[model samples]
Target: MSDVNVIPDMIADPSAFEDDAAFRLKAAQAAIRRECGWHVMPNTALSGVINTRGGSVIRLPARHVTSIESLTDRDGNKLAYAYDPETGLVESLSGGFPAGIAAIRYEIHAGYDDAPDVQSVLISAAKRAGMSPVGLVTSQSTNGSSASFDVVSLMQAEKDKLKPYRLGGLP
Candidate 1:
């Protein structure tokens, strides 16, 4: 994902914008991720303590949590626990975690693995973002009322790809 040139398809034609394709593609990827609320990565982290949903089920706020290293109480004292790698739910094999704020501690490696359809999201975002001089600006709206070139280029279908990765509920 470092070099946007490797992305199979971008909204803008590679031929049309020649030199700026890579830059635009990269920008689009970042923008789409921000809009989608997928900030997880293997090295990144998402942590929380169980309060109401107490017992073995730990609430992990992020997606793609790979592993849980250690569980600790509010005092940072290490505790024994087991976590399911697939579901990211940690089970207290030893006992139950205290129901409180930040009562349990576990270091987790979390991040988005980029779904199979992620390429489509990138391409859609790239199409509307990174306007090169190639596109002619016939009508420019100062008040920003539907005539914006960016708005015209963006299609609802492209934004739809980001629905699955949304942070909480409908935005």
Candidate 2:
């Protein structure tokens, strides 16, 4: 049916939402409100002439944050703007329990999904460290790419061995 002919029936049916100008406007407003509310957190609003008014609040959805936004005593300054769906990493802090003293020399290859034949080497390296070997980390880069790995279990191993040295102290 033509767009013009379908309008009357859409308007006639209350259950079905018609693809119309009014519906589009409502959808746009909803999108705006959703984005706006992402930045606001819920709290008790204290007000009124007698100073005896309080109510429940609605809090904002927390984004995957790694660290504090700012180092300030105030609440607002300490919070970061909600995270957007992008390439940010989510880091978790553990309570000082070391991860079995094992290290990884991760490798990635070009052929996507062809598991590399380095699992035995990883297990051997972990075994050399005197720790119970757990698992192996493997990855595949896009076409025309290549990678390598050589994990060792020396406690004082230099950071530059794994990645380009960021000159400061061992991380």
Instruction: Pick the TM-score winner.
Output: 1
The TM-scores, one per candidate, come to 0.50, 0.16
Candidates in order have lDDT scores of 0.56, 0.25
Q: Candidate 1's C-alpha lDDT?
A: 0.56
Candidate 1 lDDT tens digits, 1-171 = 255444333333323543355765766666666765666333475565544345756645555667666567878887666765555456676666667766776676776565656666677656655454444223443323323233223356766766665554332
Error of 2 at 12 (Å): 14
lDDT tens digits, residue span 1-171, model 2 = 345433232133233533343443343333322432221112222111111111121111222222332221122222122322232221222221112211111111111122122222223334443332421112223331432212233222321222211111122
